[model samples]
Target: MITTHAAIEDNIKRYKRGELIVPSDFRGKGTENAIKKTLSRLAADGTIKRLGHGLYVLPKKDPLFGEILPSTEEIAIALAKKEKVKIKPAGAFALHKLGLTLQVPTKLVYLTDGNGRIIKVGKNTIRFKSTTPKKMALKGELSGLIILALEELGTDQIDESTKLKLSNLLEKENPIILKQDLKLASAAVHDFILKLILNK
Candidate 1:
């Protein structure tokens, strides 16, 4: 029979290098304490790097930079998993992710189905804001992001250049998927996405 550490190690081998991991991911695999002990040993071995409280990651090492830290998105995804909720980029971060904004947001917000929580990682702040079911309906989809980005930019504020870029992105999506995802948006956001799609 495989030992607890061996089994945990085997399971960890499946995670990509630099992937964030939490103890909850090992649920049903072993006792909570056993998993924690195994993780502690692995962390000491430098096989995994411990992040904030209860957060660990298999660091991605670069030849010149040594171990690279995980991105905000990676950390946010881990938080969402820990909270057992779906999350999506919100406010200026959504526009930034889409290359519409050159400005990097100092604080990142994610609309989540879970309770609001705040986490500080390095110099950045990650916040999860509880949102209605409709706001989170397409949390995992491309269109959901478009809605949030447009909401951040507002219709009048979106310049011609931004509209062109947004239009081009919508052109690449499947019509059926786009139509389905748009249903999750509010009426105003839906109208904006429709305009972007039709104008492309």
Candidate 2:
């Protein structure tokens, strides 16, 4: 007979390996109350952190600090994956990486192909916005970051220095897949950057 604590331990191990397990995963073989109780006990012991009502994750360790680093995206991805929803990091996350925005956004947003929701992980909020999967995927990781930056910075904000730096970085990274698409979408900024690069 598998005890509730034993089951919880097994689930925890699975979660550490990047598997998302829900209460039903264990309840299918045991009493729902037993599984819930065990989960609660594990959460209280810090073996798992409860993201929201039913979402949970095994805390990831920070190698440098030897402590758990709180990240809303990681939890959100785990939850979305378990729920069979497709999600891609977007908005501020992409913008910050693109150097178009200097501010670190408090909320981690993602474009998804399912219902949107706000998930609370610790004190951080993860937001999901429903969008076509093609659009979500087309915004390659770096392109998405650039788009976010451009959105925040606006077209006129692409000054000479910033344009040169961005162009150089993009060239180095060879983000050709998104170059034409992003340029077409951001005509003003694209022309400005092109002129600056030519003049330099």
Candidate 3:
């Protein structure tokens, strides 16, 4: 008979390096405590890395960096994929991603069409805020990030320099996709972005 620990270990090995793991992934192999214990044992032996409560990963090895732990963005993307949810970067993080800001935010925030939750991974915190389906309907990568970043800056805060930067970015986006995504934006954002698109 295969022991619970052995069974769980085997299942974990099937995952690719840097793949996230949760106890629920081993549901049928053992009882909840046995599964948790097995995961803890593996993490203790360096076979896997314990990220935080209920999160583990098969650490990827890098030549220079040694252990290649996942970034907050990577973790958020993985969690969204696993949960079958849609997520887009929001707030200060969105601004930073769009080159509107140079500072890196310590806490990462994403708007999701799924339940809102906070996950702490090492020094970083990943926040998923529940949002409407329309907000999640953005089809263009550049357009989505621009909308979120603009929302973070707000109408009053936008200046000539910022508008210039946005205008430059708008040139890189596909006109068709940008036009389609604009329909999903709030009235203020739609009008703001349309003005830029029209001026281009």
Give the TM-scores of the predictions, in the order they appear: 0.66, 0.65, 0.88
How would you encode candidate 2's per-residue C-alpha lDDT over 61-92 as one tens digit per residue? 66686546445666677778777888766655
Rank the candidate models, highest lDDT first: 3, 1, 2
Check candidate 3 and list the clashing pairs.
Answer: none
Per-residue accuracy of model 1 over 20-90 as CA lDDT, tens digit each? 88888888778999989899999999999987666789999899999997877779987787667988888
Number of the predicted model whose lDDT against the real structure is largest: 3
Model 3 lDDT at residue 178: 87
Ranking by TM-score: 3, 1, 2
In model 1, which runs have C-alpha deviations exceeding 4 angstroms? 1-64
Native-referenced Cα lDDT, model 2: 0.64
Per-residue lDDT, model 3, residue 27, is 89
How much is 178 displaced in model 2, in angstroms? Answer: 2.9
Q: What's model 1's lDDT at 43?
A: 94
- Show the lowest summed lDDT stretch of 10 residues, model 3: 148-157
TM-score of 3: 0.88
